[model samples]
Target: MTFPLIKHVRAFVVRGGGADYHDQGSGHWIDDHIATPMSRYPEYRQSRQSFGINVLGTLVVEIEAADGTVGFAVTTGGEPAAYIVEKHLARFLEGASVTDYEKIWDQMYFSTQFYGRKGLVVNALSGVDLALWDLLGKLRKEPVYQLLGGKVREELQFYATSSRPDLSKKLGFIGGKMPLHHGPAEGEEGLKKNIAELAEMRERVGDDFWLMLDCWMSLDLNYATRLAHEAHKHGLKWIEEALSPDDYWGYRDLKKNAPKGMLVTTGEHEATRWGFRMLLEMDCCDIIQPDVGWCGGITELIKISALADARGVMVIPHGSSVYSYHFVITRHNSPFAEFLMMAPDADKVVPMFNPLLLDEPVPVNGRLKLDDKPGFGVQLNPACKLHRPYTH
Candidate 1:
């Protein structure tokens, strides 16, 4: 049965409790925090904080039809994107057809043309697009992946990504990532220190389990090579975001120097299929890590996955496994979803859709299992009371 065209599109700006949520460390793209309580909460003190902290805002788009069928979506990121959705995109989207997502995306992109593409505008668009897709899936009574096409695999695998090796091992994750730290002394010493840390983590996690490191865009080719070489001795499987995104040639060089069987994955900050195309064409990375929320939502992610798959590249999405759960379940090529280990506070504030046990590693044997629930399979916690709503 064909669904009716959308009758109304309403956008709500929801503020949750937290401090300044935007000030993520330099070079990290897409701040996924709820911004609220700058005044009410003492944690909002920016003086004590170096990064943007707080639940900025959640842009929830609800699409309704004549038959009373409704769909909902929520965008991550902080206040800036939320403002765009509430003040800008919502009016333009009202009464628009839900099925015409491409048209809607194009119109929104053009409307914000003067502002340029990427960054906050695209981030906002990502959220709205996700919500629309969720609504569509609900309308059809199918999971978002099935609506996209069909499942690629019966289950999706996940990597236990964290900086803390002890916690990861205690949590029962076979594969874990070490958080990227700055070079110990800022130059060569720091680089040596980083290699040493990875070597230590390797000793901790043992040789059989998968071990990786996120450089967090803090290394040059020379330093990365040094670290990768040391990492290989301890059986480090992959190194993520080792070089800055602008260092394409450097990555090519690093890839050449990197030990065989060691994979390089990136694209958490990269936008759209075009950005990924450049990465693939350049042979910049072996694995692709696209955040479904930031890398143009599920709509664009599916396309990006296809692009990666064609090249035999693995697609492992970054952040909030809850949002990515359905997509991972459906997409065959996406091998795993990253579970952030340093996000206990964030998770406590915005809990997972289906919280994983500390004992059972996600993907018992390299296969992820998704809860059979509708609309991203997530429900907001009632305990975390909303502070205020943004109205245009």
Candidate 2:
């Protein structure tokens, strides 16, 4: 019997009705509508501009088998990511075997070696890899996790992620994350302001809840140490993206100073097992945040998680909560997945098959729940209004 081979791959750039996904007020970037009083440097002002105002791009891979089974995968990003999907990835995947996902991934990785590894190349590879996994699951009549190894956990516990105080209260989430703000100013004043905000967030969630703070690469070692100290006092669980990736020594130092029970987490921007291996070897972080969509898709994430597991560390897949939801439920060691209350109108922007739930396995008492649906269990909403098509 002949195995199924992928017939075609297509990419799309869909513009959704919202601000750039990253520009939302976790305090990293200012809303574009607000004009700065000072004549700031061009680079500084541009960084503050909002990119989430519209859907920059979404890449979907449709793989058709000889038997007519169809599988889909999607990855979203800003201009660089979108450009790779549109200009390069699909051509490489054309006529490839969906069954040999690893081989195909290797092919893409080597092909793009000249462009250097990771970043946009791996991100684009991530989309294709996910679509391939989705295709494989459909072909085998099993969920992607089962295909990877098997279920480690039947259900997953999730932390509610939001920047808005009222939304966090309404969601009844037991765990919440605050957006990363720039580290304290030159004086104690900035440090004082940060501590006050953390205290306020702690009060909002009460004593029983879990809380994390994202620094969004906004702090240096000195500032990170100070904030970590205060955050510990507030009972914060972890400090994420506290410093730039280059600050390995800073991370080691920050880790040493962090409160006893508190953990240091980062890696959303780091790529592949190589990036993570360094973080692990250096003892830089207690928890690793790998995006299944970004870190070479399911294939590399499984590898990265195993690396973390061997080191007695934890794996928490970043955004694309819908994808991570299914991925996490199947994994045994993944601690918690992030549920973004602040994500762009998830229900409206996510495909129909991937509808956001308001009930159990999601926002239950204080935790988000998982479903037993087949494959990833999410179907693209056939009713989704924006469906643009691109062919290679």
Candidate 3:
């Protein structure tokens, strides 16, 4: 079968909550007192935004086929990422076969290898790669899952991430993950407060509901180990991203010393198959969490998943809304998905990427059944203004 060649590639930047989920306004739960690496500074400890976590607004990448079909994706990168897409990555897509994503990805990765093995460069590549897959699904007139492979499960079951696991339980979710408020910098009193919060939530939700802590890469080995041992008493399912993504040895030690039956998971910030290889080979954690938008998109994720699956490790992607859903439904290792409670109070379920995507799906009773629509089954909201930051 013949395919239309890629016609053009474009990049745009938008502010506020779209893909840069961190660029939220005041009082949003996501930015409220979450522990981070910068928490050691007294001035930056209260809010993540205070430390410039949301400096990168959102970047939108669009790829148009010669046949006039357009596929696009959003991720955290802003104007810098837009520049990478327009000035560097677009060259590999224009005039190539729409289905030549493998070659295009290789070109994009290696061409920028001097400065682009991970972080912002990989983020830009990921946005472009996902747009290509969306384009392929549209061209084939099938849902992205169908193109990847038929569904392994009928529907996806989700655990909520928020400040209120108690509220999430009332909403019918299977489990809840809360951010660890105080880090190593806060001393013994902060440690007691952290455990107190867990114990209180455990009592409210009762036992058997999964309760986990997201440390957000803010702890050292000693602190994470102590926290995990303490949290285990309250039936903590896992302690996530406790150490820096680069600290493989710390993760290995923490995983080993962690209370029996508890999981140690990380990888939201790690990118590419090579980075994941280190984690699996070193037996870093029980599960691996890769954000689809940040971990080299679907193409690289496939390779990363295979690595984890071989080692008997679970693959649970970080909250990326539809981008993660389409891929999760197709993998056996991906047993359940994550739904981040973006509601300001974490009281009601809201679209994870609200106001940016039209027809975005949300869980009903903590479960979601995907539709047959093609290309991730979403459209960019016309109401949100988008600025083209660069032109190729």
Compared with the true structure, what per-residue lDDT tens digits does model 3 show for residues 226-330?
A: 999999999999999999999999998998999999999999999999999999999999999999999999999999999999999999999999999999999
Q: Which stretches of candidate 3 lie over 4 Å from their true place?
A: none
The lDDT values for all models are 0.64, 0.65, 0.94
Best-first order by lDDT: 3, 2, 1
Which candidate would rank higher by TM-score, 1 or 2? 2
> Of the candidates numbered 2 and 3, which has the greater TM-score value?
3
* TM-score, model 2 to reference: 0.83
Ranking by TM-score: 3, 2, 1
| Residue-wise C-alpha lDDT for candidate 2, range 1-392, written one tens digit per residue | 25577776655444431112443444422232221221123334334443332335555555666678777666655455556665677666667777777778777778887994876678778877887787787777877767766656655566655555335555555577776543443247656866787788778667767878877676778878878887889898999977777677788888888889999998887888888998899999998888777789887887898899899988887766556766676666686677665444322112211332212134454455445444565555454444544334
- RMSD (Cα, Å) of candidate 1? 6.4
The lDDT of model 3 is: 0.94
TM-score of each: 0.81, 0.83, 0.99
Error of model 3, residue 23, in angstroms: 0.9
Query: Compared with the true structure, what per-residue lDDT tens digits does model 1 show for residues 181-209?
Result: 54422556656666787778777767787
Better of 2 and 3 by lDDT: 3
